[model samples]
Target: MDGGLMLAESLPRTSSFATDRQRGGAAFVERWTNARAGVIGFLTGRGYSSCSIAERIDDRPETVRRMWTLWDLSAYGHDGRAPQVVVPLSQRDRAHLAGAAATAGLTIEAYCEQILVNSIRR
Candidate 1:
């Protein structure tokens, strides 16, 4: 999931919808889908309540809640291959990260994942 988000973020964001329409919709759909998933994953992983997340994303709270319920159930199907890992940070560091994430229009978790992946690649 982290890798997917990293790859998606690496892509350019300049072309307009007109260009996308001319080229066909696959790229547009794929990019939009990845971005949507990244936002949802980031919000949920960062311990935001569904209502809060929905408000932030301009979505309905019930829709966000339902998505979360489905996500939780799907995690159990991972067969222990994707155990959750906690990374502790100082309050100041967390505040900094939250600000950065908000500026980038991403959840803190997604922002952190992107940072980690970039660091690793370097």
Candidate 2:
């Protein structure tokens, strides 16, 4: 999905994470860090080297390599069970939501996932 559309779909759910500053500490950072590492690992497992993954994600080679070392291979076992959802939005609305997501310190995809998770809990 496009970044703008992802952001637009997540804007309404940003509030859930935004208000929970305490939960955004070490654990939150670690979660995202591990998740990134997991992605690098996944790509490498499929034969994409750290350099290639870095280039694809616009990250530094050294960073990607480091993440690769940190990736827990066991994490991939849960990948198939993760939920998937799609939300469509107009260009203008997507732009607005992307801006909002940036302000909330989240990538559009993360913001949307958080929102969906929050909605499910309610």
TM-score for each of the candidates: 0.36, 0.34
Q: Which tens-of-lDDT digit does each residue in 1-122 have in candidate 2?
A: 36423232232211122223335555652223444555555556544555566665457778765654555433653232242354667899889889988999998878887887899999
Which lDDT tens digits does candidate 1 get at residues 1-122?
45223333343333222222323545543233445556767656545556655666556778766776766835543222232334777899899999999999999978988988899999
Give candidate 2 regions above 4 Å deviation.
1-78
Show the lowest summed lDDT stretch of 10 residues, model 2: 11-20
Question: Per-model C-alpha lDDT, please?
Answer: 0.59, 0.55
Q: For candidate 2, what is the lDDT?
A: 0.55
Q: Model 1, 48: alpha-carbon shift in Å? A: 0.3
Off by over 4 Å in 1: 1-32, 73-87, 90-122
- Give residue 26's error in model 2 in angstroms: 62
